[model samples]
Target: MNLFRAASLVSFLTLLSRITGLVREQMVAAMFGASAVTDAFNVAFRLPNLLRRLFAEGAFSQAFIPLFAATRARDGDAATRDLLDAVASVLVAVLLAVSILGVVFAPVLLWLMASGLQAEDQALWMTRVMFPYILLMSLVALAAGVLNTWKKFVVPAATPVLLNLSMIACAALLAPWFRRHGIEPIYAMAVGVMIGGVLQLAVQLPALWRLGMVPRLHLTPGGLRRSWHHPGVRHVLRQMAPAILGVSVAQISLLINTQLASHVGPGAVSWLTYADRLMEFPTALLGVALGVVLLPQLSAARAKNELGQYSQLLDWGLRLVLLFSLPCAVALLLFGEPLVAVLYHYGAFRPVDVAETVVSLQGYGVGLLGLVAIKVLAPGFYAQQNLRTPVKIAVAVLVLTQLLNIYTVPRFGQAGLALSIGIAALCNAGLLLTGLLRGGLYQPQPGWGLLVLRIVIAALLLAGALYWMQHHWSWLTLPKGQRVAIVSGCLAASVGLYFAALALLGLPWWRMLRRAAL
Candidate 1:
């Protein structure tokens, strides 16, 4: 398989998801601004997301995919199908119980997540409404894992676009309808979220069905018990034990940060969230795209005992990480205010909000390389079924993050929170890379020094260009269309300049495609 081609497919689809996602956020910020109700929605929405990461994408995917790949390799289609059924049965039962508990404990969850929220009742109501989204997303994650293992990457990659479109529709249309009906307009966002979840899950089914990999869910008490005892199910649970610890450490950090942001002020959470939406564009386009493509491939290589292939994959992914993420980090740090102004300076969103969000965006940009690098590095341990190492590293990073927050938050406010996370990410990525090298799991390829030099030179040129563009425009004072036009032109020019500089510096631009042919 061409890894570059696969990663490119995921990246292109993810770009669509991120574009629609920005439009969704733009609508939300325009209609609501960084108000109390928007904070409520951010807090309420995070409830299921925290759990979804823990249960579905985080621990579950880390544990399930490697084992699933290995099982399919060692056994046959029949055995793999039975394993899927067993896993799906247990997963469904667990999700149902959790969703119910979440709804019943909505108030407690909201308070725990954001006790300082001014609109507690509104948050509680939205929390209850959106809590069950975890159920839908978990199933979607399951289908994604299956489809990805089969190298059917398109459907899962495209699934997020549906959610983004759903929210975009709700924010544009449903929000106004709610206002007319004397209902809270922000409540429509929660409704849109659930709608999106359903659509996301619905699309995954047909994809799975086409591959004949649809899991036959068993809900009966006897059937559930039998599934719980299945060997494959037990194996997955065992893997998840450490995987959960690893994932929980990261989620717990987010939980703490959310709690902290709530205390900062009304718009604090929204500011950080808006900045996160922008950060996620490049992170998803490059980092997530590579991670999704690499994990299954790494697992397959490991299962076959192809040690050389495993290391080569890591090397390729890391090089791509440095080559692409450097220019993005530079752009985010240097050009954030203009990006924020053009995308969000509308309706209720004010000039003040733009300034506040720019601080957080730059903080996030400070560690963009590390943040993206982790997406590639952690899978090195996960593909080897060594979840404990990353868990141990995460525990230390968690402590370090909070310590930084203690020093920074009181001094710099919510931007400090973002800065702490970014700094911690750099440390986390460094430790992971060190572990891989010391264990001889990865050997750096030759010419890395030259590669780094060329990338640095290219990034410097890109940074200079962005700095010039940022100063030349009075982005906040400009009309919307003019602002959009200039920002779009600057982005195009910046990308072109970065790649042209890399080419002139003797970097092999075609090597990414050519290496994949091997």
Candidate 2:
């Protein structure tokens, strides 16, 4: 697959997913507001979501994809199939045990994660309802990795659409039923989450099957033993062990922020979650999708011993991230209040909620480049089958992140939690870049100095225009339709000027794209 073409497809699909995600968040904000109930839901979701990252996104992908792609490239189809069967079967048994334990120990987990939660019992109950989502989502992650390695991006990318649609349907339909039955409606959201997980896993099955790579589970005793201990599985196991540490350390930072937010106030967790949902828009659309496409290609490049191509792909990723992400961060930093107001200042969501969300949104915006940069750079380490470097970096960043939160959270509340995340992201990107360059693993492309200058100049022009526009409009006072129209226009103007600045500065837009393809 053409790297940029594949990246564009993933980006478009992911953009749809994120848009649906925004609708889902808007539904949550409208129904529950930044209340203790929303706090309960956010805390409940974070634990399982963190685990999902560990098994599915973080450790597993970092470890699994490079190895899986290499197996496909060098070891042939039969061996690749054997690896999948072993990994999938063992993964099922492990996750089943872990999910059961999670449900049984929900309160303990909740206390560890958010001991300061004001509505501790409510959060605990919600945590139990959502703990099983980790099991479901982990399986979904494995299925997704398999499909991605096979270049079947459609099913895996489209699966999130089902998840978002499920959540939206449940929030709109089932929550009201639960409320009518005198049950807390968030319970319905938890149920929606489980259903979504099932669909996410199930929807990707046909894709795997078409590739003839679906691993069937053996239910009998001897069969189970055989599937768990394939010789090829040992390499995956070794890589995964260190990857778990890296994933855990990374999650520790988020958990620290969530825990700190709990201590700050009743609605702090909800505010942070809401702000984070918006902050994730660009990260999801550009950083994540680009990373997904780059991983298998990079792994393939490494298997072929193409170091020059490896450096070029890595450089391409960084260039695209900076080119797109910098302007996005600036836009969010400047227009965050209006953006928050337009999207979420409705129903149970009040002016104060918007104000709180805007603070955290801008905080997160500051780190957008770091977040996007990490998506590509960490893959540089992973693609070379070097997991230890990222583990060390993640550990160091986790420490620095919590320390910053210690000083910042008390001063800035939810915004501090958000800001600390940005600081940690920047630190991670810096460390990873340093390690890559110093290790002599990656070579920088030419024109980086000029590229950085162009992006900065364009982003500054966009920021200035946005700041000026902000003074001319009363975002809160305008009618909702008018507010959207005016903000949309401002966004259009800012985007145009950003590109125009880049062009007028003698950096033709196509030059960046052409360089990335090198």
Q: Model 1, 291-315: lDDT tens per residue?
A: 9999988898899998888999999
Instruction: Measure candidate 2: CA RMSD.
Output: 1.5
Worst 10 residues of 1 by lDDT: 509-518
Q: State which candidate has the highest TM-score.
A: 1
- lDDT for every model? 0.93, 0.86
Give per-model TM-scores.
Answer: 0.99, 0.97
| Candidate maximizing lDDT | 1
- Where does model 2 exceed 4 Å of error? 514-518
Score residue 455 of candidate 2 by CA lDDT: 81
Stretches of candidate 1 above 4 Å error? none
In order of listing, the candidates' clash counts read 0, 0
Model 2, span 209-261: residue lDDT tens: 89998887764678778876776567877898999999999788778778778
